[model samples]
Target: MKQRLNLNLVISMSCYSSLYKPSLFHTTTNADIKAYLVGKLQTCKDLTSATLTHSKAIISGLSYDTFTTNHLINCYLRLLRIDHAHKLFDQMSQRNVVSWTSLMAGYVSHGQPIVALRLFHQMQASLVLPNEFTFATLINACSILANIDIGRRFHALIEIMGFGCNLVVCSSLIDMYGKCNLVDEARLIFDSMCIRNVVSWTSMITTYAQNAIGHYALQLFREFNHLRLDKPNHFMLCSVISACASLGKLGSGKITHGVVIRRGHDANDVIATTLVDMYAKCGCVHYSTKVFRRIQNPSVIPYTSMIVGAAKYGLGTLSLQLFEEMVDRRIKPNDVTFVGALHACSHSGLVDKGLEILDSMNVKYGVMPDAKHYTCIADMLGRVGRIEEAYQLAKSVQVERDGYALLWGTLLSASRLHGRVDIAVEASKRLIESNQQVAGAYVTLSNTYALAGDWENAHNLRSEMKRTGIQKEPGSSWIEIKESTYLFHAGDISNCNQRSEMLSLLRELEERMKEKGYVGGTTGVVFLDVEEEAKVEIMSLHSEKLALAFGLINTPKGVTIRIMKNLRMCRDCHETFKLISDIVERDFIVRDVNRFHHFNNGLCTCGDFW
Candidate 1:
């Protein structure tokens, strides 16, 4: 019998061998060397004659160059073998910043941002000088974690390293600050940049869009076109679409769709999803549906966006239809997709459907209910007067104890809606005790107490907040006018241009609202033992009214007014905006901390659910 040596066995033996003596493997071509010694490299198992030319480079005595290490890291990451990747990286005799950065990237890519940050700090402690890639990975992790302090320190380090002008690092910094909710800082960085590439422009635009600075994003997009040596790509068009969605600038959004079509990005799934979101948010339900159907093969993201849009606009049935269609297509839904779907059911008061879907989350899809999912369910239940069940469900959730703020806030607000003062007081206590630092919880709890005639308890809660050094956040709103944004807080008299005129206009709007049966909503004066007039004055000067008045006076007649609030819009303001829209015969869109509210012809999109 002829003894036939198995080539694969020999290669596996060689690949898995520990290189005790590096010299034994020195003779192999780099193309013939194996970088990692696992059972069988997936790359090798599928190897063809064509890969033979490059095989020697991967074997032992292989130049374990940084490029080779990066390739190995890529393979392991693709295989979801992060542990092996880390082990390989640790065993390397010579390691550079690239090796460290690649490992950090693996951690980030695997959604372990904290691990990535840890490695970054370790690399720093080891005195390994980092490069642009390392800083970018670290900054990206900081962005997701929203560790502003860490991000700022990294920013200073980048400047120290003289890498601030590096385009890649600059783009990452802009993205970091943007995602960290520091949009102004991001813009500052963008403006100071000596060079701006497509990535830089995209990051800035998307930052503005994400921050709901839609008009500014559009302005930047126009500037981008004017300065461009190249036509707009899919990413740029997507950002513009998102900005349009944020602002409810549907006319402009449609125009951008035309641009996208011209640029041949209209069929792109990401662009299509953004377009659907824009149309839906702009109150153009028909166009939104049309855009949803135009995508021949929609992905989960677009489907989710469409579902969310439909739900937000009160097209609950349409949203359910899309959800069913998504399931039929066997497309897996992510957490965000479920939020939209469940939110739609909540909006439509489809209690049975909502409960069924919530159960199926774990039973069929293998995804357990997280805080956001539970919050949505609670919000839906609370909206429809299922207060006790909502409270029980909230109490049952163990993870995300901080979510009690949102859950109890919802419960308290619902109690106020239905005159369930007893439950409101109970939930309020839970809320304040759970997270006194959350301003919204304080506001909700206080309002609940006021509704129940328990002003003393409400006052005590407010006093506790103050004593604990938890300052109530000012009611703040943003208005974009003529390509510039102006922020207004309660009682703001900060306008240099036509200050007296703006103040007078606000006073007039308040009087007009009063004449239309809108009261001052003095319930917000939980801490005040004085007359209601002072509280009324305070309510009149609220940031939403100020911003709305500014937009009214500054913008063209019949143009819609858009405002973004840092907190939930007060009940009085939500009602007042309804009256104001009817009075001015114009549309209004307010994105608050919780959700979007659109007012047109004295009707709110929320239908008073929020």
Candidate 2:
């Protein structure tokens, strides 16, 4: 109260009489002096400069000037001195909307979004209405919070306040809805906009990309290009690259790389990190390495992406090598970084190394193991035929239901592979009764029963799944040839333009494979009471095989074929790829739900463990 009352007299030179003095000033020079102080406060790039200018402002009696005070608050915020900024804010005698909004933004930026929300309530109580920037900052706070209920309330408030069409607020709403996984709601906001800029497009595209709807993201990007609204900015390009990685569109990914180079965004570390992940997900880890190597100063993100990428293709040594190098560089590894290291250890049969990394995660790096890291550890144990140990670890992880199901699912997958039906049953049973109802565990357990000739159990599990409305995710495989993606599903070529030729090529490959002692793995087939011949035929037409056939027919011999599958590659397909690779003298890379398998010369990079 005292500070607020004193602010009025601050401009009166009589009040500043330290011991006895009041000084006279020229009106033009005094105004010029105040304006110059405000400008210096506005432009202070660091705390030292900002504090120095602030001292000068106080000596010049500009500290209590509302305009100058607002600039100082913003400067302190830019320097991340949120405490100082808020102190100044509370001391302000008169605060306009800019004053409130700037402080709220600082809170949001500093990750104190609840504090920002409280500030909003106080601002409203003060009869200060929010502007577009204020709404934008609040909406961003909701995004970080990921509270859709509160976010929806903000959306309603924006509409109530007639800010529905404001570009900045609308863009923030799109981002908020996207983070909440309400894609259609976000798209509705985007479509209703009268005009859209690069920020709007990037927000919408990022929403689609991050939500696993990459096809829609690609469609949006194509539309953006058709309209030629603006050159795709860094964030927009990064999202598109991520979409390409998900779809395994190497050719389109290459074109995106060209754009990156053309726009000189190739050197940006953030974009480089995204590109590293993109290439790694697209079944091109070597290309990921090339992009990662170009970054002179490596951060945790790029190194983690590189490590996880190498692990995906069973390049465990390289992944661990990168991990050691990262630690030696004094770059602290985050939880995700440790996940990558453990994942590398699991996939490459480095069980001992993986255990070491897991033990050191908390002790050495101070990274507490999360569900993902624990999942990797379970996978490592399961892969080495330690099914009981893996099962016990999964049961002991102390995670939520979803994470519990995930760990058990991994154990079930390993059990099915290792002929441990007892472990699979317990894991599946626990998963079914758990709060998180998932389809993978049920399907894997059913498949295990079928493989072991326990058809009754398989039928019962499927019936239970159907009764509960649990649907197995339909499996699909994609292969890109000449910039166009071709998709296939099990025993289905309904979408293929060259179905006849592809089928003939598949038949020929089977004949050649059979000639080389390759037996159709009908025992691994999940069909109930099916004839052997029928099961063999079904196995021959699996999605990945169809994709591989298409790739072989289209690409030249020895051109490494890449296939992306939405589910884990079955044991039969894994075996078939190994034989077909040697018989046809071509290499194949298949990225399935779990990991990458590189097949060459009658061997898979996974060494048949996967």
Candidate 3:
């Protein structure tokens, strides 16, 4: 009732505003009236003020003026009164490119990309040549949709329409390609630009960082500094830090952290959240916790990052504590927050807790459960040897047809781990039937057969894979030694110049390992039909083991050796490292494709569960 009364008073004042200043209105020209309306619209910070000012404009006969009406539309959008903005736009007698572009941009910002696209088509059909802003806005819409086809269409249009050099358009193009996973094309655009701004540089770097091309991202950051471009802002710093995280480059991450501190961006929410994730990913969760604690009032993202970090480190209890803290503080959890929570349960073997959270996702948290949540739950079940339940849960996931690929792959992986040949075959069949060319699924099944000593089946599977052109992605790992990264593939030491020293050190470690009861498992030797001794030798040369050997010899005794791998660490290497850690009494951090394993004193942070 009070709200209605205040609104009625505003209406009365708006209707009688001219009467209150009759002499001024009589003396003022239409231009003066239009200017006054535009000024009012510019300062309209709230819906009530905007509506009052809008009514005054209508009363003063300036509603028909395009410039003033455009201001009104913009002001209405600023006040989040989209209905009023669209109604005003529709009623406009003269619609310019700005009018269409403004409405389209509003829709895009409001997460309605399809509406923005429709408006763009309508704008084109109405014969209004889109300005740079229009092209940039629609390109952003394309990026949000991650639709490369539409992005390409806009790229061609921008080129033909002579907007290719426009900074805004070029940056949007780079971002669109990045979002579409066309990192190479994004780099092409970034390289060809005759003029580059901070936004473009950030976009290109962000593209590399997002795509796991962290080394390239660091290279770009170095060039960005060499060119003496604008100083790196929080956005660019966040991207560089993310690159460090992806590569698990603690040295680089520390340097970037220094930059964050010097620039006083440590307090910035986005940068702080990114720092949490970066430290966590770089195998430094203590730093992550410190940053998380320093946040004045942490949001869902920061909490989620910390939770995910804990989950990765097998600190499931801590993850749940942070989650409860967030809820107690009245910070609502988003879908990603729930994902991190579920990951905590999955990683820590909290099966009952995971199921409870999954069940409460929609009912208690108001966040709907999707295939992603189901994947975590299924993993939690699978980790505990509930293979059938996991498979059934994976089957029950209802999502986009393509989403089944992850489900199938998960089931296949779990089945392979538990030696469930029947379920592994079933998962592989589903993969084939769904036409999901997941090379990893076939590789897992083939490895499963080999592990079962069914060499004939394994050989046949390999033949089938060759016939289908589904080659498994080769596994590789790299370690950063004294700021230089050295990569190694299975049994391949040709790429490193210090291969002999690395081999010598590896042989010594193996001798010490055997003395410490480390008879290497032959489980990872699936592709070969070699003798057990030969298999142990083959396992010793796996990429991650080679990287570890290199790190152990090169780094100082007290320093933590960090290595990053492109695939999950094999069980033999996992066990070998546990023993090597005990023998050497040094900390070794291995960031694999799955999770980080910190081996210290014959114990892994994963507690041997992972």
Candidate 4:
């Protein structure tokens, strides 16, 4: 009898642990152990009825108990067999908070937030009280739905249930509020927290960054450090780096880069992407490219960020080259990648290239063209003086949301550039009728009327704009000299340091350029130019000239002056700046109206395409 008992024990143990494992008579009695095995068996296709029956030994022992029943339900959930899980949950004589919470978690995990909420309601009706986990699961549903109302109600419910102070629950609340455009409220909750983790810090910083409050985000980052709390993690670093990008603070971005390297978090892909984006946006494309090259496992986010950064910094060729490399690596381009590519083409006036890509947005890439893509194409055409083609392309889009603003604005700008008054006037009228308070459309109409020699209409439009209190944005330009920047605007004499010198130099430059046969293009004249008034209006109060005068007076001899004009550089100014560059024996980079004009030895890189 003893020998017989020993034989049976040996058989069971061999089945449980053998290499060529037999699948029966498993001897575990812990429900945790059995549930774990059942979850594993559900994943293995070859595990048969014999093994499952062995699992049932412990499952059946705990079948009537809510704790074990919840465990069984969770096992089915791991298999996504929610139906079977629900069946077991229903058959139990009792239901507990854990059972409902487990089911809710399963639904949330599977992206069925609505189903999760429905089950929550059912649980509530069943008289099962919710705990911290229950509210956290429901808040997850609200975040997915972007339902602020549901989120608020959940907040109230958590308070009523005394779970509001739960750090996990409050963390999710901050995240939900931020996603729903309630950053202020999110901050209120975040500040009210008794304990905060890295997640809490990262979420708050990200909220401020998303809402265009970069300074506050950075301030928070400093405060986070001052706390001497847990060291900054990858998420916290990325959040603050993104804030630097939005603010265009290259110094802060560089500091963050140093932090990333020092902390050894540079290996994280998310941190890598944010750093690339920050440097790119801060106008340090070289650093951006360098960081991008070092990425060991570059993903779509980093690739897209680098592409966009290159495009925005006027490195259209580099952007396209990297895009080709991305394709060569089999990395798929998303909508953002195409948008950046199209913008590069537009900015560089690569018309044929832009057209090819716009076609491929739907053909090769399967991304339907959004309004932004169409706007980039239209902007490219208009910048290259293809007013009629731009107008036609604008018409062919079949749907126009804000494209009307873009299309008409582009056409009107092209008209102003090439002296196409008729087209400008027609487009401007439609634009004004559609968007009554748009200051740009009003300015375009006034400029068009002036170009058409209709002084009455030009003055009337200006007067109308004034009566409606629609003020045009003041034209300004920034120039970096001696590592600091100075801004200039029309009629601005407020830089007391250079007032007299700037005006005198501007007059001298104008006179010398005039002697070189450069005349102000009276084509911008409205109400018939009587020569003097046209020249005065064209020459003085021009934003580009004001910026140039400031640069000329402030800089040393032979120093290159770079000015960016908020409005298009008039044809006359383009010609005048070329002669000024020659006379001053200095290069001048003027980014105006539409494109870049680099003038040296009396030539523009654009060759007058703009």
Candidate 5:
């Protein structure tokens, strides 16, 4: 009886075990767990909480593989949990190239390029070879840091590792070189490439344009047009158009605009903004306004560009209107936008409006005024003979080194204009103390002394400059005609072919001006001992006048003559251009280093204020 009972018990146990076997064996594998965690990390909206929870769960439940750990690090980075990511990275039992690259990228994305570079060096020390992505990320870091030597080291490594042909790597190299101001090296790399893409072309084009080699930029764009590969994108169009604008090549600019329209990129925000800027800088405010109006929902950049364009051409009222409209549209103005508004106020002699805007910058818009904004306000005040207010305003700002220098420089210029010898001396002192290398301050002070009839002091300052080897920059001007640019320096008689005709045209214009009751102003020349007649003669051969003459003689009748000068327009030149505009029955547009001067009908857009 006992043996029979035991057999039945054993038989019952066996039956129960077999019945529940499939359910008991249904457990998740490591791979399945990793996939589930990855999905949660990727799709989670609240990445901070979800990522933290999932990462902890991952740590507790399973031994994470390299792939799983990399994903977790990436998730932490996305959540901006750099500390947690670094901890996990350090705790990893075995790290691969992906592991190192993941953390390096995290550092870069967080704006810690230096930390990223350190991680790269650490990875190199650990003997883990970086992949293409690693190399690309490190190259970007180098670009941001502007560490050209470090970038070259990596380039050498890439070449030795046979990864130079990788398109992404090559593109990054081009960008790195470009940012380092090594455009020629960038071009060499570009030319040597077996394959090219849109990004590579854009990088080279932008480099040339930004480095003041706009002509080269245009030539590159022409070459890029012949390539049957990718079509020019909005970025490329913006860069090339900016190049045209800088060179004052309106013809080339129009051609680029046609390309933009043909490619259906005219509506792109960057393209539209750049087009507005291009037209404005090239002295075609009408075209600029047209382009700006075409945009459906313009942003701050476009609005600011339009405002600045209006101000550049002396349309201050329009600029103010645009500013008000932009505010009404609920768009927040940035620092640059305010600068444009301030510049408009200054040019229009709107002292109250400019002051209101300056006050509102911090109170209403939360945009703190920087050195440039302060400089504009000071300049405006100084222009209207409010020297005390301008001085106080500049002195009130606790600006950086460069900003302080700029403020003082503006004050110095204003003093020179208004014949405030005491203020000019103080400003000159401050400027020299702050930036001893600036030649403008010394020259301005000398000129101020000469204006005050203190010729001895002026001569002493001139002697000091000469003793110190502080040579002032010679003024130069350029005018573009039919795709060719003619350059002239102060007292330049280099172009013998056009010298006689230019001088003759200038003399005729002078005669016409004299008949219209325009007397030559001797204030512009700084040669204290020279006779008044010689001063007038020397002033007549100023670079801007020569360029204006060249433009008038070469261009068609009734066309506006545009000249670009490397320095501020002198008082005499300003008066001469106004008279010439009326006598020639044409507009004279001069873009000096400071601002634009539009002379028409015996009046200047600056309202005789600039």
Candidate 6:
């Protein structure tokens, strides 16, 4: 097709012998010139920069009608030369709605959504009423800004102009609301829509997934499937697979993968990458690797996903190997790739390697360290008992207040782990001064006091937290079995039917763990003046342990148990999981808030580093 277009372009340019003679060009009709230019603009590939430049030279001397000018503007926009398009738009003697919309769309395409919005207001002030496309573009701008107020205003105008029912406008509104973190509002608009298309459905699915309502997204996808109004496309499948990954639903993800295969989209790069991510997040690294290897000449997305997945599973060596391979293949590492590599290093206790990567990121890859990158480096340093170095690094780096607070919090956690009370105090003070409402700082400080045998100070801190109306977030864990997920909170006994059995199994495991020299660590329990036995009991009822016990009772002996936690695993729980894995001879994979911990034969992949 491109060859044919190029041949036509050459033929058309040759026929324009009048280019050398203005008198002959003046004889040509405006309508005929406009028709020819518009055809070329529509057919020529945007990446063919040389051809576009030649076309631009040819059109420079010709008189253009509004129709031809609009085509030229659109052509420049498609080529991502927004400056050229804007200049052309400004030089036009007369403008119409098409002219204004063309420039606005150009701004939006060029990642200047704010500029696009400003131009939209200017167009409205000029009394050139926006068409449906104009409204759609403005709504998308609102979505990018994530401004709910502006989006509502656009929605009002859309309804006032009777374009609320237009499929494109409605879809944009849904997307805008979703990006604003108003998924309920997005859903309301979706439900109210009288007409829907594939794009609309996909937008709503993506909205739910983006808002962390993955289960709802999957449910909506199921409803869309039941309707059978349209077949699922690659975009829809990708969104659904992402939702499954978020919920760690391996069964549903596999079903979706099967659908992708049946639809012959398994080879598509995007779908393949999504599949790899889904399987990896679901604790099936083998399957993720299998999907990744099937792609021929895989791009950075799949490679980065695989690296991050390996890191999540505590396969740091494997992640590093993949990074080296990617470099050997001459696929330049992006910021995300470096992040995965550093994360893998941190999880595996490769502090020196992580530092080297951090130092070379800007020099070797031309990727500067962002806040996330710095945080990974701080975590790596802190993991290996280098709290002072981590703290100094955090202080030296220029980051936003939130990033600084996060770094301090990590330092505090490391101090607590390594019994560095002085450093913990310093980090806690800095964190509190920066952000008074950070509940983690208060909790960690109180725990630090408890660990130091200062029960009175710990109690006072707890009282202070109550007085300040600050409450720490509750820990929760979930496990999936037979396509169903069961959630448990810390010390929760809500499941009356299974609570007794779970508790009995936990007790049996506790005895076995005790026999294997697994003594409970009481530092995690913050209660003052608690007996040692009571503290052990309290620690045994942690959410992850409950999930683990449930998995042990229900799953076959040989099957691996996977648990996902909403917070960092406590020391007691981590040790217990290691012992349990050895006793039951079943591998345990726990995905905490930070990273993955694989327990096997009384050992963890983190090597007691995390």
Q: Judged by TM-score, which candidate is best?
A: 3
Which runs of model 4 end up more than 4 angstroms from their true locations?
Answer: 1-131, 137-150, 400-437, 451-455, 469-610
Candidate 1, 1-610: lDDT as tens digits: 5444443443343345435555565554533444333223445432232123124334454434455655555556656668756766765656788889888998988999899998987787888899888889999898878788999999999999888888888898898888876889999999999888888999998888777577678898899889865677898888888787766565678789999888888778888888888887665667878988999988898899888877765567888999999999999888878888887787678888999999998888777778777777877777667888987887788745655555566666666655577776677678767753366556556545655666676667667766676655444444433334445543333443545544554567667766766565542222232112123111222232223223211222212122233212122333454554664456544433212212111112111222
Local accuracy by lDDT, each model: 0.64, 0.70, 0.71, 0.65, 0.69, 0.69
Best by lDDT: 3
Error of 3 at 213 (Å): 1.5
lDDT of 4: 0.65
- lDDT of candidate 3 at residue 83, scale 0 to 100: 71
Cα shift from native, residue 141, model 3 (Å): 0.6
Superposed model 1: Cα runs more than 4 Å off: 1-55, 58-60, 63-70, 75-84, 121-128, 436-610
Error of 3 at 555 (Å): 22
- lDDT per residue as tens, model 5, 311-359: 7555678889999999999999998788788878877778999999999
Pairs that collide in candidate 6 are none
For the record, the alpha-carbon RMSD of candidate 3 to the native fold, in angstroms, is 6.8
The residue-by-residue lDDT of candidate 3 on 1-610, one tens digit each, is 2242243454344334524443344445866877877888898778876777777676676555577778888998887777767877876767999999999999999889999999888888899899899999999999999888988988998899999988888899999888777888998888889999999999999888877678788999999989997899999999999888878788888899999999989889889888888877665678999999999999888999999887765678888999999999999999888878887887667889999989888998899887677767766777678989998888776866655665666677777766789998998888888878466667677767876767678667677777777765444566555456667553244466865555555567657655656566443423332111122111333332333233221222212122233112222343454554564455344443322111111111111111
lDDT of 6 by residue, 1-610 (tens): 4442462353255335324653345545744665666788877676464355435535544423456667767877887778767766675555789999889888877789999989988887888889899999999888887877888998998999899999999999998888877778898999999999999999999988776678788998999999999999999999999888877787888899999999999989999999998887776778999999998998888999999888766678888999999999999889889878987888777889999999999999899887678777877776677878877887788977656665677777777756678887888898888874267777677767776777667667777877778876544456554544556543333442455554555567657655656565442422221112113111222332233223211222222122234212222343454554564455433332221111111111111211
Indicate whether candidate 2 or candidate 3 has the larger TM-score: 3
RMSD of 6: 7.2
Model 1 lDDT at residue 215: 69
Q: On a 0 to 100 scale, what is the lDDT of residue 554 in model 4?
A: 24
Q: How many residue pairs clash (N, CA or C atoms closer than 3 angstroms) in each of the candidate models, in the order given?
A: 13, 0, 0, 3, 0, 0
